[model samples]
Target: MRIISKIKTPGALKSSTSNLLGRFRHDDDGAMSYVAVTGALIMMVFGGIGIDMIHAELKRNKVQNTLDRAVLAAANMDNTMDPEFVVQEYFRAMNMSDALSGVSVDQSLNYKRVTADGNATMPSNFMSLLGVDTLQASGSATAEHGLTKIEISLVLDVSGSMGGNKIVQLRDAAKGFVDLMLPADGSDMVSISVIPYNATVNLGDTVSQYFTLDDVHDYSSCATFETNDFTSTAVDPSTELGRLGHFDPYNSSTSGGEIAKPWCATGQTSAVIAHSSDADVLKAHIDTLNAGGNTAIDLGMKWGAALLDPAARPAVQALSVAGFVAPEHSSRPAAYADSETLKFVVVMTDGQNTTQYDLKPEFKFGMSEVWVDTRGTNTLNDDRFAFRVQDNAGDDSDVYYWLGNSGQGYAMKYQNRPESSAISNGVEPYQMTNAELYSRFSIAAVASEFYYPAYVDGFLTYDDYANAYYGYQATVNGSQADTNLSTVCDSARDNGVVVYAIGVEAPQAGLDAMQDCASSVAHYFDVSGDDLNDTFSSIARSLQMLRLTQ
Candidate 1:
């Protein structure tokens, strides 16, 4: 009965239910604690995943940088290097071989491009719980190279100022530049023309015949341009334009004996080399460039620009036939609009322009001769005032003489001389003063066997004597030379020539000329003696810089 009451009574029942509830609550608390621990573990795993992702991103950045450099080095225009191998070598060098894949290369005449894409997978330190066993990092890089067909004309100043170390430095720097511009293997992609200019631009023996000679003195390779030449941009040899002579300034009377006609003729000619693709040939020619004579910037610029002028096609063609140029480049001095070709001129000078002189004959020799004999008595038989003139005797065997001065009408006398026939001494002589007779004889162009007695008046000055004895034209002074240089430079620029002027330890005149000649002031370089190599290298690198199009 007591056990039944405990099982059935309200107090006993309530107590039993409370005990069950308390047990249930205890179980709930245990389950909640387990859930909190699980949440913390999951959070820790996610945080590790974030850290791994950041590490992978860092690795990707490093790999991309390495690959970028690799592609650039591999895509350079050296001896056709294998792009894939070069990239692989770079990765190996960087100790990132696992990050390289999908490498490719493309090349053309004027451009070379390379692309490399790669990826790396990092073992997961966390996140494996969610099946993210590893993290992938990828990178890609592309690089393009620049190489273009170039036709360059170097108008070098071989003037007296470029004599000692200046020339040596120039030679070394120029040779180095050539080495950089030219491929180790032979290629016609680049052609260079060297024009060493002084008082004149010598087109060499082969290039001289292209012009018609104004004078019979092919003895010199120098020629002065007429005003028309400055106005005209085309250096067309077909125009029959200029006279060819030496650098002799003719003088009939001087401390030394009379200088023969064409006084300035007979000096060393300039050295000119046509366009050549062979670097060795170019360097050899540079070695032969000696320094002498006055500076003629206009002449140098003119000839240099002429070589790049479209009008010079005939000359270029002739050169090609003569084996001075490659046959494939026959169309050189290519049309200005040709995008595939670039024409560049590098003009260097260390000094300013100087006076230029040419020959101008005043008289014709063997045509006539006049002479005065002061020692002889005139027709009046006056002493100390006698004068005589000689003329053609009409007949080869006869001679005619006229004597008078002091305003006394002349008297004509004939003397028979059959041997004087070659002199054309048969004409009647006319009265003339000593000064007048001297002037007449000085102007005679033909060779005459005439003699003159000493006179009191020094009728002709040194310059006059020079002009009369030899055919020196009026002198073109420094100012005129500069004007001419500017003229020719302008013409060249108009024709689309890209000029780069470098002045080494030059004067103000030189600086001005170079500034005017350059395509822009930025293209001009004003360097001291030792900085020449740096300037040259800078230019070479600029020309060789890689151009990335993609």
Candidate 2:
């Protein structure tokens, strides 16, 4: 262990240092160690940058989710709070109030839209080494809750079956629905037409003025629709509608009074209230509904769809001018292609289609063969016999005789023509027109007092008498009514009209028809007891159309 220190000259020292440096550079013993050190430094820098990116992404996701929920809550039409305040509260509850950048809200009486922008900043951990101090996360979202315009046709069944407690419940439910649709604040964006249908739809005087109807009688304002009318959704004002005759076939008493329960419902309250947003007016009309006729679901559905169609715009404008409809809705019932407007029909029925009565073509209007001997009183009673002029086919001679109380034959005979001769005392016979005859007597009364006697007298067969003047003919049967309902419903669906069908304790046939007519299975409601109000509320909620636009 002798440690000896040796010193060399400057030139020798330089040569030795150069030889040692060359050896150090060329040696392979410690090469792997040097590479491991450099690799570790580079991995550390990249791993820190990845961590910073992950933190920024997490913050961005939090901001995006919060903004989305905030905007949606703020856009809700039912939310009465200020939209900006709502959004701030949403972010504050999530402990991210500092991340909210700003909020924007656009609103109207019927619609509300909200947009929210938010951002968050995450301090960089290792990325700062590459000149980055912090990472930024930002997002924006928008949501809207409303339909620009809504047109609803509420077709209600006021048939005989809907009488009693059922009608009372309907009135309450319908009035509640009206209150929901036409808010007290009053938005002109929505208009509702209440069509109450039984055997026929009563047009009322105001609504009937727009249509050209046959001059049969002015007792009631109801039209007889052809089967082809159900194939389309427009009730053309230019088309002439046949007026339903005012005659009661159910009552046969020869009493001198008005015919009870004519085929058409004849009253101001039974008439349709079209394109109105006044809750008071609509509710008042609902209050006066008296049920007495058979069901006509097809007619109700047709009228509901027709009123929503743009083809009825002219009539709506006329109604608006007449002060029946709100002036603001004169341009409503917007075109089917109008994206901003929504058309909906809520058809509710409690029974299936029954027999619909209509007069025969020959009996609808004109002079009749029978003459009334008024006895100078001008009143039609049992004492005032109706004289019939029967023809002898062999000689073509007219034989006039007064109809007797019995259904077999005449009570008396007139030698000369009855119109010219004094039938009783000094009272002359008066030729009765068809209108006068129907107005004076019921169909049953005429058939029993005149036609039945003719059949018994062998002048006419039983079948001919029954077909001629007995009860009214069934112009529309049940099967045909179902077909018509389906046709109109299909037309409505094809035209982009949303149909909501409800069967309130209805029969199987009625339920089936309503289900088939609905826009979807969910749109059809088979409600009973106390379910009507809930079903209507569900429908109202669905109509809100709330969604996020961004």
Candidate 3:
């Protein structure tokens, strides 16, 4: 009895231990309890902060990428605004859709900085337990057009063959280009040197010091209509080529022995075309043009280059962009910073090269009527070209290769003409043979006269003959005599001139050349038979597109 009482019962001891454990679990007491509660709360707060910061960082990164892309797009500044709108809109959409909103592009100019900014609000994922609801993120981007400058030269073909529709289209397009290049705002920065061409460009007395007998071929003197007033009476005053017969600048007596008709038809045609910067003057010149002349594209290009030579305008150089610079840029090193101004060239042509082969009158007795074998090929074969020999009258009698199926027989070659009328008197040689005989004349459209020889055999198919005629006149051996116009263009590019080529109604080779000459293949445009306004507008659109991209 005494031992049991002293040891205390096992049940009692167990009850005591259980009570202590329950108290420990239920009571908030002591330093350990305080430490546990504080640690958990701290962790929750930190987790919320971490999640918010991560989301904010992501939003900022996204905004940065979009702004970078948009700025780059603006830097390329060309004539088109569509691309710029598309680029800026895309980023704006992304910003609005994502946690971000209020993204926008401000001041997108070629030479100026393009800027973009955006902001975002995102919910905190892990921090919700700590009462933290959201976080904010923002970003910005900016870019600038480079300091490269440029010099532009325009080598345009205004040959006699470009008379009708082609000339009209060119006048409209060229003027549009000038308007585009004109300073949209500010004192004009870009400089232009205009070269209006024919067999020779007319520099006028102001630049006549550059002209001399050396510039003329054959006659020892260029036949100025003013110098030969008596013979120029038949010339019309409304046409550009015809303008030669009169003189500009009113004088009691003008250049021609005859009193000048106040103004020559073509004299002001490109009126003040090359010499002035005023839009009104350019407009007047554009109004006066009437196409007429043999093509001398080489001479035209050469003179165009001369206008932009750095040595010519030391001061204007600072206003020019160094290279790859166009009209739309916002800032650049001064043009006068270098020896030359920013330079470039846009060469355009409709008809191919043509040399006056022969202007000899048909009335000469026993004289062989000149015939040009217009069967020129793109592929140069020595044997086919071996017989080419041009005489003083620009006549090439020897046949190299023919490009046709001969029509009926020899008799059909010479069609009906009254034989008694005499071939020497410029009678239609084919008509002299027989009334019923259908004839085939090569290049009949452009050539003034057609001749059929006595010993001729079968005739060629009319279709083949026509192609050979016109094709030859416009290709390798034609008015634009060189198949390698691109070589010259590329050379010009290396010398600081950006080359823009337009292949309007062009052949494959011509297109290829244009692609190579353009700043890029995308810069090249092919315009076939189409509306003039639309064609010019298409070109304008392209120019704008290029500005936006590059």
Candidate 4:
């Protein structure tokens, strides 16, 4: 039996095809695979973008760090090369020279400021798919090296203990410091005041004229400050000060044109050279320093702080007019609140504070009881004598006199009835003032001739004679001097003044005092021999104020 295939009509085939298509569209099989492929594509895009962003950040950080270092190095005051060149070299060393866009340098006599800007362009990797062809990394930095105005006070110890090699080393170290601080081009922005101190601070005649000093004698220009003066940094020019006596307690004779060594040094070497920018003048003054007196670190610090105080501006201006201070520094000792100015004080000492002598108020001025006969030879018993005159009535009535060896040769009391004829002929009695007495004879000679005779003649008691013998007394003891130093040091720091102290082979007390006076522990130096030079050099480096501003 042969069978024939049946064929469907066109309409029936179309209906069957439609039914198959609908089933295919409704089926859920393999639907998860399509979602999985879309998710993977999204994840790949995000990961690539993150990687490109991290790479750009790394490049940005590198540019910023390199620019910061370059500006800082270029701003260094000690860098002799061109600032722009220095910055360029720094970038070249980092192999990022092409990234440096620009460099700017601003410099003055004592100041230098540098600014740098850089940018790096990196090709975008995965980010390119988002139409970003390149990424830019940019950085900027600024640095400042020096202060606009710098005032420094060098308080050097020229005491007897600083003799020999110690002084030589100090001179070399201090000169080296000057060379570092003061540029050879003669910068007007820096001024140094050299205050060489020992028993007292000698304000040179040019500087002393700006102050109101007691008119005791014209022999020296040393002022005796009160205890309260150390509590503040100001040395008011209008403040009247007591004058130290010009008598020497060591020598007994004024023969052979020998000058008395007064409590205050009289020579130009020990005097303060205020607010000078001339290194040669300052070094010359340092060369003349001779160690011969006791230590007075307190006085030295006081003058050092005072010279940096704004209250002393008038005196500085006066000094400038008088040619002692540089004319460009006439306005110096800028206000403490001035942001553009910086002040520093360097105190060096080899010993602790010693006795500071001052004449008693009674002996400071006015007539003394001692009398001299100008006609006789210059002998203690014949020429100079003291009279013990007593008013019996207590109302300027009858007076009794005990004449001291005026050729009468006896301790006899004579009534007021003795006229000029009663005494020996040609024996002219001259009542000398205390100032005159001290000016003519040494303190030792006066004590020997006058005080001893008064005690022997029963006019003065033994205690009274002892007091009179030592005309000068200690004004401030060692302990009190140390306290004064602390007070001044604190005031200086409070006023924004940087204090650096050095103890060169000093005793324990001296070292402690210097350490306490320093602004911080790092600001104090304990050294000996040649180490002082290194200490000063370190200080010079610290004072340059090199720092990054941005």
lDDT of 1: 0.66
Better of 1 and 2 by lDDT: 2
Off by over 4 Å in 2: 1-61, 107-111, 123-136, 144-147, 372-385, 391-397, 401-436, 469-471
Worst 10 residues of 2 by lDDT: 407-416
| Comparison by TM-score, 1 against 4, better one | 4
Residue-by-residue lDDT tens digits, candidate 4, 140-182 = 9999987458999999999999999988988888888888888
Model 4, residue 518: what's the lDDT? 98
Clashes of each: 28, 0, 60, 0
TM-score of 1: 0.62
When sorted by TM-score, best at the front, the candidate numbers are 2, 4, 1, 3
Model 3 Cα RMSD, 1 decimal: 17.7
Looking at candidate 4, the ten consecutive residues that score lowest on lDDT are 413-422
lDDT of each: 0.66, 0.82, 0.43, 0.82
All models, RMSD in angstroms: 11.5, 5.3, 17.7, 5.6
Task: Score every model by TM-score.
Answer: 0.62, 0.82, 0.45, 0.82
Looking at model 4, residue 384 earns an lDDT score of 32
For model 3, residues 1-550, the per-residue Cα lDDT tens digits are 4655467589999998999988887875662576788998898788767867887888777776776676566545542454446456757677554533433444333344455555667787766666777767776665544222443455666666667787778777767765655434522444445666665455443332222322212111112322222211121212222112111122232111122221212233332123234445454566566666555454455445544443333212322333222334223222334543455666666544444222111221122222222123222121010111112344433232111112445333332222211333342222111101101222231121222121123233454334323322211234243433444555556665556666667556546656766767655667753544465555443333222221
Candidate 3 lDDT score relative to the true structure: 0.43
- Model 4 scores what on Cα lDDT? 0.82
